[model samples]
Target: MSTIADVARLASVAKATASRALSGKGYVSEETRERVVSAARTIGYVVSPNAASLVTGRTKSVGVIIPYISRWFFAEVLESIEQALLEQGYDMTLYNLPSASPERDRVFEYFLARKRFDGVISVGVELSDDEVDHLHRLRRPLVGIGGAIRGVHTIAIDDVATARLATEHLLSLGHRDILHIGGNQDEQMDFAVHSKRLSGFLAAMHAADLPTNDAFYACELTVPGGYEMGRSVLGDPRRRPTAIFAASDEIAIGLIVAARELGILVPSELSVIGIDGHPYAEMFRLTTLEQHPRRQGRLAVMSLLANLDIPTPEDASESTVLATNLVMRSSTSAPRAPLHHA
Candidate 1:
């Protein structure tokens, strides 16, 4: 490997002059700088990134802590953020924090302490007050996605409003007895997302004076999870709700599947609405609210990068809820005249 000494000898300049020219920190004449650069290129010389970071105090990398990777929305967001970082010549180091546990402490006390990252972006997993303070002490910028932090820059859709919108869509179709197949909020140990979504469903039900009780079945936030819950809920056709609101598109797809198996045709006998424009939504011909998770990811990165240079705003620790659209599909329809009973 060619060294700085070799470049200096080839450029006919002292090592200190070559260092000044290459580092770009101190002044070097234009002609001298050009010669040093040319000599570097000729010798196929490359500066040590670690050494550069030591001098410049920048790692040019961002650390990301995400909760889940198997989910469609989160995975899409991760991919978008990765691409955006790559485009900007920044590296991303991912830390998968599946459900809050002692492992998260290791990430905070050990991994993040390395100071290898210029900033941090959290996806879906909300950080605790202590965690935020710890990062603040380290002077590392932090951005969040999925929901707002009390004092952190974040990007996400209003879960409450989005859920209410889904419910209202069914109500617009004249669905009175609506069931919400939602996540098991009680089991949500890491984040408050499930409760927020459930609250939105209840808020809409209260606004319309509808039954949002146990008929509001709890389901896993996946297609298979939704299918299992849907089968049991829809089995008793005599008690099944006229319409269903799934917390996510995955659940909605599962509900639709269960409806098919039970000989209950969608829209004709039962209507279903879901959040997220999951890829399968198109294949299953389901109605959904298209919340661009990838766009949110990119936006979070932008916000985080901005904070790396300037101190984040007082409201920077807050959240910016992105907008969504009601992407109407054939999955929703008016309740049957006689109310089809299995």
Candidate 2:
């Protein structure tokens, strides 16, 4: 096995220069790099990873920490991140953090301490001060998606604003008796996205002087969650909110199903709106606020590459905020007078 030392001796270059030249990771003069490459090729020198890490201090891998992989948005984000990382010639190691505090702590204390990746992308995993500091002290660059970090790069839609937009759109169509089918109030995800979205709903309702309190129905962020909640909330014809602003398209789809099963009609009887451009959203013809999680994942990778290209400053972090727009569809309209108060 030809070692770097053998390449250095054959090329008559210093070991350090030979390492840099062979790896193409750091700065090396063109002539020197070519000579080193030639010598490496001649000797069939394959750089040892352990040996290379001892010199360049990089694992050439990325750590992606996420909360929910089974959910639509999270899955889409992961796929986009995977594709982007592959194109950049990098490897991604995923860390699926279960919603448990002790397990979450173990990820930071034990798993992160292993130091296998060059950097990290916390996909919807909010980092605590200690966790952030631990990674920072490890000299790892981090970028957060789906939430905001106190002192690191982040990219996400304004969850509150987007929710408000959805609500107001329903209100604009004169649907005042609106319900919000959303995530649990005890969501342990990094960003309190569920809470933020609910906030938007409340803010919009308050702004329009519409009824909002107790109108919120909490559920997990899944079709089943929505379906279960819809059955409970919409089961009673006397008290169902005329329109609903579901947290995600999955929830909206479930709402539609629940409504139909209960012999209630859509648009003519109840209006529905949701966030996330879920694939089933189109199939269900749901009106939604289209924030593409997959595209957001791609953009997050782009941002990471951008920061990786330049020299990352120790004390400074680069942040980028993406944009979201409302996508109107046939899921919503003014409630009929029978379902609305005049």
Best by lDDT: 1
Worst 10 residues of 1 by lDDT: 310-319
TM of each candidate vs. truth? 0.88, 0.83
Q: What ranges in model 2 sit over 4 Å off?
A: 1-22, 25-56, 99-102, 309-319, 337-342
- Model 2, 111-228: lDDT tens digits are 8778677778888877777788888887677888877676788888888989999998998898878888898888544588889998999999999887667888888777888888
> How do the residues 185-286 of candidate 1 rate in per-residue lDDT, one tens digit apiece?
778734566887788889988999876667577878999999998899899977888899899999999999999999999988889999999989999999
The model with the greatest TM-score is 1
Q: Which segments of candidate 1 are over 4 A away from where they belong? A: 4-44, 98-100, 313-316, 339-342
